[model samples]
Each structure stands twice: as C-alpha cells, then as structure tokens.
Target: MEKSIIIGLDIGTTSVKAVAFSRGGRVIGEQEIAYPLSTPFPGWAEQDPLEIEAATITVIRNLIQLPTIDEKNILAIGLSTAMHSLICMAENGEPLSPSITWADGRASLQANRLRVEHNHIYDLTGTPIHPMSPLVKLIWMKENNYLPYQQASYFVSIKEFILYRWFGCQSVDYAVASATGLLDLHHLKWNKEALELAGVSEAQLFKPVSPTEVLVDLDKTIADQIGLPVHIPFVIGSSDGPLANIGLGAINPGEVAITIGTSGAIRQIVTEPKSDSLQQTFCYGITESLSLIGGPTNNGGIVLQWLKETLDIKETYEELISVAEKAEPGAEGLLFLPYLNGERAPIWNANVRASLFGLSLRHKKEHIVRAGLEGVIYSVFHVGQALERLAGKPTTLLASGGFGRSPLWLQITADVFNQEVQVPISHQSSAWGAAWMALFAIGEVTDLASIKQAIPMQENYMPNPDHHKIYMDLFKLYQELSHTTHSIYMK
Candidate 1:
C-alpha cells in the first residue's frame, strides 16, 4: 500500500525549510536552504525577494526528488512564514524594493512619532507601533520619498509576492495581515484609517483570507520548474508564531507557546482580539474567532552566535554549550541583558544596548557564555510576565525552536519562568502546524482540535523551586538596571 504525505514549507528568517510528513505525523523527508540578510545601513535589514523565492523553489524541488517521497501520494502543500515583511512591487509583479524584514529599524524615528501621536492605533489593529510594522515602514517611505513607495502599484509581504508568482493573485492569510498594523482586528479587513495614515489605499493591499484557504491550478511554467503538479492544492497557512502554537497543541486558553530561534516569542491563543493596555504585547488575528496575544524578543540563540563569532571560539556549538554548562547558575553574580539586537516587548524600545552587569575579575569566558544564555532566557521570562498580565498566568508551555534542543536552555527557561515546559518530539512545530492545517483544509483531518492527539510530545521540565527563587531576585535587578539606563540609550 502507498502511504500519503503532506508538505509544509516554512519561510523562516534565516532559512527556508520544506518538510514532508506522513499521516502519523512522522517526518519522512526534509530539506533546508539558507539565504542571506543584507544590512545596507546600520539598523536596516533587507533581503532580496527573488533570492528567497528561489530558495523556496529549491527546497520544494529537492523534497520532491527525495527517494522517500512519492509525488503521487503527496496530499497538499501548506505555507508557514515569518511575519512583518514588507515588499513593494510594480503592477507587472516585479519587485521595486528589497524586502524589508521585521528586524529592520529604519523607521525608528517614524515609529516613535506614531507611538505618541496615534496611541489608539494599537487598540484598533492590535499591533504595536514599531519600526518592524509595515505601517511604520510605509510612513517612512512616504516621508523619505523612497522611489519604490512612489512607483509601486501595490504593497505586500513576501508571502503574498510568492503567492502572486504561483497563483497570479495577491492573497494574504489573516495571521500575516494582522501583523502588518494595517488590518482591523474587529472587522477582519483592511483599515481605511490606517491606509490613510500610511498614505496608501486598500487597492495596494492584498486580499485577506483565512489560513486554510486553498488555491489550485499552479502556474504551469513555475510548476514545471519546481516539479509540482499543475493541479496540486496549496493551502495558505498562517504566520509561524500562531502555526507553531497549533503544531504544539497550544491553541487553547492558558496554553502558551514559546519559540526561540533567530528570535524569541511567548504567545497564547485567545477567543477574541485583545492587546495590552500599555501596548506591550501584539494581538494578531488567527481566525475570525481566534487571536494570538504575545510579546516578541529580538534576542534569542542569535546572541550566542554573535558571541561565538566575536570571541573567535573555535569549538563546535555543542562544545560551546558545554563550556557554558561549566559555569554555575547566575554566572557567579554576572548578569547579562540580551539586547544585542535592540529589543521588543515589556519596553518596546529598540535603542537600548546590551549590558553585562556585576561583572568582576572572577568572571571568565565560561561565565560570559553562561550569562549570555541566562540573559536570553531571562528576556523571554520578562516577556512572558507581560503576557501573564493580559492573558492570566499560562498553565502550560509548549516549547519549540533551536533553543529547545538544548536541555540546559530548556531547563533554564522552565526555571526562569517558574513553570513546567514541554517540548514536542518534532522540532519543526511551525511546519507541522502548517501541515496539520493543510490536512484540515483537505478534509483529511476532521478538525483542528484533533491535531493534539496526532502530535507526539517529549519529556517535560519542571521548574526547581530553589532555582526559581534565585531567578526571581535576579530578574528584579535586571528590571531595575533596564529602567535606570533607558534614558541613556534613547536615540
């Protein structure tokens, strides 16, 4: 008997991953292709849209060619993408500007202005006024007279641009659109007020659709290039954050999903649209009836990467982690704030710099490494606290991402948050979530809720009361230091 399979294509910040899953939630085949992120100027991050699109095609084609994958048994392909990428395109579908990713802060000045002038914008869109938002990016473009902003006939995300290439239509899933700061959370449509503020019209935006919306009849020329069937069904899966929650069975209230890869976030699913009173968290729409509330941290495993390169460490990643494990908890009174790449959530400030507080002559290389890990986990804990305020305390945490692979990191996260953390056996939670959504869309699965039983889980980490107590005090000091230095770093 031939086995059936579903493909989940995840467009992440660092790489594009194509995963093939069996009906039993087993990964049969997978491929990943990394792409480069360009920083033309300090604080500005961009990527070539065509390069990402090519990477996407390469991964899918490579997956199809795998000996374990049978094309005839392929059911559907679902997409999972990083949120808050903006692209300007000409009417003929050519990109007029480089893709501005979520990490880009060229519009910091504009974002700060919006935060003061349009405080109500957060309440309406459920997205914070940040340079990461397309709304702010558009305003910056308009004010600076970016050629693409003026000549472009339409504005869309990388996902929509790819969809336009594949299906010849500019369609955006609700989850992706919600992160743009231009969608009305209540109405599930483009907000006229936001458009006016952005100096753009609804006509420039893609049509917003549900996550499970399916598109058939692939573009023949492109289909042949990628070795996909012309009539294969494509499901427009939601953003990576919400899909990661779904993949980990963290969709219910009180179940929080935490991911730490190139970046970090702590999110919970709610039945209605909501935001933090202080605008500390983002509440992006998942479905008409479901919203994702959470905070994102700019620092994650990437901080460790920076450390490894900057320190000229020659050891493998596992070896470096072993070095960190040698240092005792709290790094012997050395506290690190993991804001090397600015910050988000709890403060929403991007101008703050990372600091190593309480550093003494006793601190060594291992201590610095250990402090870096603690700092990253502590940042998540900080964000998690804000989420706890808005959504009540999270009863469960479903963990995913590169950081989750580290037993030490996982334990640190659990201990810092003072909560039990569960990791899925499959690390590709975002891709799995997208695959499950594909299954539901094609009627292969009965409902989204049934996915819980289908997913396999690994060991759980319980917070040690002793460790939690110590972390609580250290976190308080971290908070004080952040507040004390805030005025010094404001750009």
Candidate 2:
C-alpha cells in the first residue's frame, strides 16, 4: 500500500510555515519562509498580499522538495491562518490595498464611535469593539477615505485571499468569519446591520463555509508547480487560536488552553452558543457541536522577544526562562505592561503602549525579565477569570506553543493563575490538531475522544500555595497599576 501525506499550512505574523505529516502522522517535512510586516506609520501595520502569496508558494514548493516524503501521495492540504486580517481586492482577484493586520490600531476612533453610538454591535458580532478588529478598520477606511474601498470589488481576510488564489473560489470559513467582528455569531453569517451602518452590503462579500469540510480543489497550475497532485482536495480551517485549542486537546466545554506564540491567547471550548455579558471576548465555532468562548490577548511571546532584543540578551528562550526563574517572585517591584503592539481581551485597549512601572535603580535585567513573564501570565489569568465569570466556573489550562517550551514559565503561570496546567508530551498541536480534524472529516477517527488515547502526557505543574498568596497581593497591585496607567498610555 502506498503511504499518504497531509500538509498543514500556517500563515502567521512573521512568516508562512508548512508541515507535512505521513499517514502514520509522523512529521516528514517542515519549512518556514519569513516575510516582513510593513509599518509605514507609527500605529499602522500592513502587508502586500502578493508578497505573502508568493512566500506561501515558495515555502510549499520547498517543503515538497524534501527527499523524505513522496509528493504525489499527499492526500489533503489544510490551511490554518492568523485571524482578523482585512484585505481588499478587485473583481479579478487583484489586491486593491495592503492587508491590515489585527494589530493595527488606526481605527480607534471608529471603534469608539461604534461603541458609543450603536450599543448592540457586540450582541451581533460577539467580538468587542477594538481598533485591531477588521470591522472597525473597514469603518475607518470607508468613512475617512472611501475611494479605495469604493473601488474594491471584495473585502476579505488573509485566508480567503489565499483560497481565491489557490482555488479561484471567493469564500471563507464560518470560523474565520466568526472572528471578523462583522459576522453575527448566532446567525453564522455577515451582520447586515453593521453593513448598513458601515455603508457596505452583503453582496460585496464572499461566502462563509464550514472549517472542516472540503470546499474546492487546488488549481492544476498551482498544484503542479508545488509538486502536489493536480485537483487534490483542500479544506478551509478554523483560526489559529481555535485550532490551537483542538491541537492541544482542549476540545470540550471548560477545557481551556493558553497559547503563547508570536501572539498570546486564552481559549476554551463551549458546547452551547454563549456570549459574554460583559463583552470581554469573542466566541468562535470549533465544530457544529462545540463552540469556543474565549478571549485573545495581543500580548504574550512577542513581549519576551522584544525584551530579549532590547536588553541585548542573545540567549535562547530556555536561558531567558532560567534568568527569569532566578529573579525573586513578582520581580520584586517592577511591573512590565506588555503592550508593544497593543492589547486585546479583558482590556481591549489599543491606545496603550508598553511600560514598566516600579522600575528602580535596584532592579536589573533579571527582574524585568521575570516581571515580563509574570506580566504575560497575569494577563492570561485575566482572560481565564473573564471566561470563568461567563462560563460560571473555572476551566483546566492546557498550554501549547513557544511558551510550552519553557518549564519555568509554565510553573510561573500555574502559580500565578493558581491552577494546575497540563503540558502535552507531543509538540506541534497546531499541525496535529489539523491532522485530527482532517482524519475526522474523512471518517478515519470514529469519535473525537478516541484520539485522546494517542495524546501523551508530559508534565502537570501545580500552583505553589506559598507563592500564590504572595502573588495575590501583587496581583491586586498589578490590577491597580493597570487601571491607573490606562489614561497615560498614549503619552
């Protein structure tokens, strides 16, 4: 029998990565292609769509060229993309403008206007009003400079744009649409009320499909160029955040995952369609039976990266965590507010900037590093508290991604959140989760729980009772600092 291969492509902030898994699910090939984020202005972040598309092509071609995997047996390709990027294009699928990332805060005024003027946008889109969201960004564009958008035949996300190039299809997944802040979560379609208010129409958009089902076939020209079989099947996938939950085995209600990658998020799956009464976060459909009611924060691994570069600490993250561990709990007095790109969830404030309060001559790099990790963990704790409040109880934390590589940070998170966290023995949950869904989609996996047998346990870190008490007091201080510093962020 010939072996089968499945490839999962993750379009991320820094680069496009592709991973190939064999029929037995062994990782056979992997590659990453770097790309730059265009920042023409202080708060604006954009990317040329053609450059991203070309990078994707190059990475996939590079992956298939690896000697280990036979290219022809590649059965399916699953796409997992960064959520909430807005792209405008012409009728012929040419880009009208650079894609605006979810981190772009140019639309703060638009978001404020919508939130103040119209009270029910949250009830419809579940996503909170923030400049980082695609909806507000679109509003800012239309109201400020309508010429570009007026010329745009279609406005879609990064994933949909890739699909249009690959399959010549003009559609996106419901899971993607759910995060766009324009789709009414309950209706599973675009919010016409928002459209009417924004001076756009549903007719000017693309179709939203299920993340698990195959939508269209890859074009022969593109497939042959990448060494895959022409007309191979491909399925649209959920956002990287929701997929991270699946990848980490956080598939059921109240089973949550905190991922710290280039970005950070706190997500949990819910069985019923639920919204935060406080409008703190967004809900996305993981599958028809399961829904993801969680908050995504813009701060996390990025903060650590910035700290490393700024401090000129050339050590790997492992060494950095070691440095952080040696520092006293609470970093003594320093509190680093990680808002390098702006923040989301719990405190959806994009006007904020990164600041270190309580910095003193007594503190050193170790203190700041420790405080940065604690800061991110505390931020994750805030999301957990928000989810707990909405869901009526606490959820288990199953962590994944770059932070998953560090033992000290994991223990710190446990102590800070006062919850035991499970670290899966298997890495690459994103790729594995996508592979599991593909298998389920094709009927190879009979039940979702059956795959749990394959998931190996790594280490479970318990909260330190002694440290927890100390951090509780510091958390109160942290909370106070957060509230006190909000007004001064832009300054």
Candidate 3:
C-alpha cells in the first residue's frame, strides 16, 4: 500500500513553494517557483497577481507531477501565505490593480495620520498603524482615488484572491485577517471603527475562518490545471508567523521562534489576545483561544546582502560570513544601525535610513561586515527585549530561516540573547507547519501537540557569557545612538 502524503503550499513574497510530506512528518518532495517584484514608483512595491497565480499553479502542478509521489495517495494541501498584501478586485473576480505587498510604503502619509489620530487602532486590531497594513493601504486609496480603488467592488488580500481563483469563494484565515489592521482581536470580527477609518465596509472583506477549516471539491478548472483530484481537502492554514512557531515546536510559553530571512520576526504563542502598551509589538489571533505576539524587523539578512553587493564581495555568502567571523565582538567600536528598509516594531518608522555610527579609519571591510551582521542581530535583540516583557523571557530559542543555516550567525544570535538556540533539521518550517495543520484538519493527526514531537531537531547553540556581556554594553550604545539620531532620519 502506498503511504498517504500531505502538501503544504507557501505563498511567500518572493516565491511560491510546494512541499510534499509523509504522514509521519518527513519531506517527500518539494518545488519552488520564483517571481519578480514590480516597482513602478519609489517606495511602491507591487506584484502582478496574475503572475503570482501562474507561479502558484506551476508549483502545485510540479509537486503533483513528481514521479516519486503517487497522486492517489495525496490527502490534502494546506496554505501558508505572507501577510499584509492587498489587492482590489473587480465584480467579475479579476484584480483591478497589482497586489500591494507588505513592503510597499505608498501609504506613508495616511499611515502617519492614522498613527496620530487613531492610536487606539493598535490595541483594537493588534496590528501596527503602518503603511504596510491593508487598513492604511485602503486609506491611501480612498484619499488618492486610485483608479482601481474607485471601480473595485471588493478589497481582498493576495491569499483571498488566490483562494477565490481556485475555490471560487473568498475567505481569510483568522491570522491573516488579524494582520490587516481591521480585525478586532478580542471580538474576532471586523472592527466597525477601523472600517469607517479606512473608508471600507465589512461587505468588501472575505469571511474570516479558522486555520484548520477545510475547503473541499476544488473548482474543476483549477483541478484540471493543477492535475489534482477535485475532492482533495485544502486546509486554510494560518499566516507564516504563527505557523512557523508550530513548525519549530515553539507553541509553549517561554519558547520563542525567531525567523530571519530577507526580513525577521520574533514571535511567541500566548493564551489570550494582548498588545503592548507602548505599541512596540503586534498581537495577532492564531486561533479563537490563542494569540501570537511578536515584533517584526524590516532589516535582517537583506542588510548583509546589501553590504556584500555594495562592497563588491565576489565570494559566496558562506565565505563572506567566514570573513566576518574573523572580527571580534563589538567590531572594534564600529556600530551599524540596520534600517536599510526603514523599520518595524519597537520603532515603526519608515522614514529612517541605515546609519553607521562610531566609524573611523580603524574600521576595515571585515569589521564593517561583522558590524552589519551584529546590527541585524541587535535589532532582533531589541525586539526580543520588548517581547520578554510580555512573554516572560523566552527560555528556548527556536531558530529558522536563512540566518539559521549559518553557524556563525546562530552563535552570535545565541550569545547576544544569552539563550540556547535550537535549529530545526527541516528548513521548510512554515511549509511543514501547514502540512501538520492539514493532517489535523483531516483527522490523521490526533492533536497539534503531536507535531512538536514529530519534528526533528538540529544543532543547539549555547550563549557565551563573555560575549553576552560585550553585547549588553554595545546594545546600550546602540539604543542611545538610535534615540539621539531618531529625529535626524525623519528629515
């Protein structure tokens, strides 16, 4: 008899990935389809929804066509999508505008005004009042009278758009809706006040559902396009951040999940919905009874990528990291504030740019590279500090994403946080989490906790007290520099 398999489809910012896993949580096959981002104007990041849908179809089709996998034994496909993308849809179900990605800052002015006028929004919705949010994006559209916004019959996220295409019905999972700055975290419904503020109505939004909700009987056309059975169950998984916690087995209190790819976030699962009093962190509902709170940083490995390109470093990323490893902690008094893409969490300012402080003739290329790495880690550490206030100081660090693949970066992160970091053996944490959710939805898995026991753990990194001491001092300096120069960047 053939083994049953589950597929996880991750619709990310840069690509669409499909991972097939056995019922026992082992990966069987995987495929990824990369797509390009469009920037027609400065600070405006967009992607063609049609292109993304095509890539999604390609990935799913590729996964189903793998010779090693038996299509008959495939049980379900679960979804995990990047949050905060908005798209305007016409009455006929076609997108009227490009999908505005989370990185887009075209609504900065509106977001600034909302931040001042509607400061209570963060508490109500558990999403920061930032231009990246769909609430702010809608406000911008209403103010600017964008052509698509004027003629659209509805507003939806990229995930909803894709689901509508495949399922012929629009729906958003709880976690995705919570990131929109429009959902009431406590009530688990669209906040009327937020709707009025954004000049939108609840009718324009998709119905919110739980992550484990299953959608069966795929649209015949979509099924034929993907070469899959129409009756395969499609589980609507939660957003990447919350699902990543499940992927890394960080569902318990005092266990934090840190994912650093192009961007980074530090998140933990909590029992109830709660937001930071200072609005330094975002709290989104993962399920009716559980919430995921964390801070996201716009700067992460991207800063390192920018440094390598700017310095014309021809070596591989591994080689660059090796060179950076040569530099001692603190990078000889040179500090870098990694706000290359502005920032989120703690300081949710989009106007700020990257800054290098305490630079002198003493600093060399290796020192600069090392400082850059330290800067990103420091930014995450800053957010972690804020998180510690709420989550009670994470006892375990479950690390994932591109940065987790590097031993040097892992050690630096562990040392900076003064906590032991555990990396998962499977790098596709989000996808696996989605797959596990599908298993639960289909009753193949007994409960969510079983996922934790099934996932394989990799190497563990322990903190060095000596390095932690140095980082503590440098972090203080970093904070001082950020506060003192905060006003300068706004100009």
Pairwise lDDT winner, candidates 1 and 3: 1
- Model 2 vs. true fold: TM: 0.95
lDDT of 1 by residue, 321-407 (tens): 888889988788889988888888878887788999999999999999998999998888888888888889888998999887899
Which residue runs of candidate 2 sit more than 4 Å off their true CA positions? 22-26, 487-491
State the weakest 10-residue window (summed lDDT) of model 1.
482-491
Per-residue alpha-carbon lDDT of model 3 for 1-491, expressed as tens digits?
Answer: 65488898989888989999887668899999999999999899899999999899889999889987889989889899999999999867799999999999989889888888989999999999888999999999999889998888889888889888788777899999999999999988999999998888888898888899999888898889999889989999989898888888888899899999889999999989879998989999988888999999999888988989999999998899988888898899889999998888778888778889898988889899999999999999899989999878888899988898899899999899998999987778899999999889888888787888778777799999999999899999999877766667655
lDDT of each: 0.91, 0.79, 0.89
lDDT of 2: 0.79
The candidate that wins on TM-score is 1
Backbone clash pairs for candidate 2 read none
Report the lDDT tens digits of candidate 2 across residue range 234-287. Answer: 767777877777777787666888888877888887776688778887787556
Using Cα atoms with residue i matched to residue i, what is each candidate's TM-score against the true structure?
0.98, 0.95, 0.98
RMSD of each: 1.1, 2.0, 1.3
* Global local distance difference test of model 1: 0.91
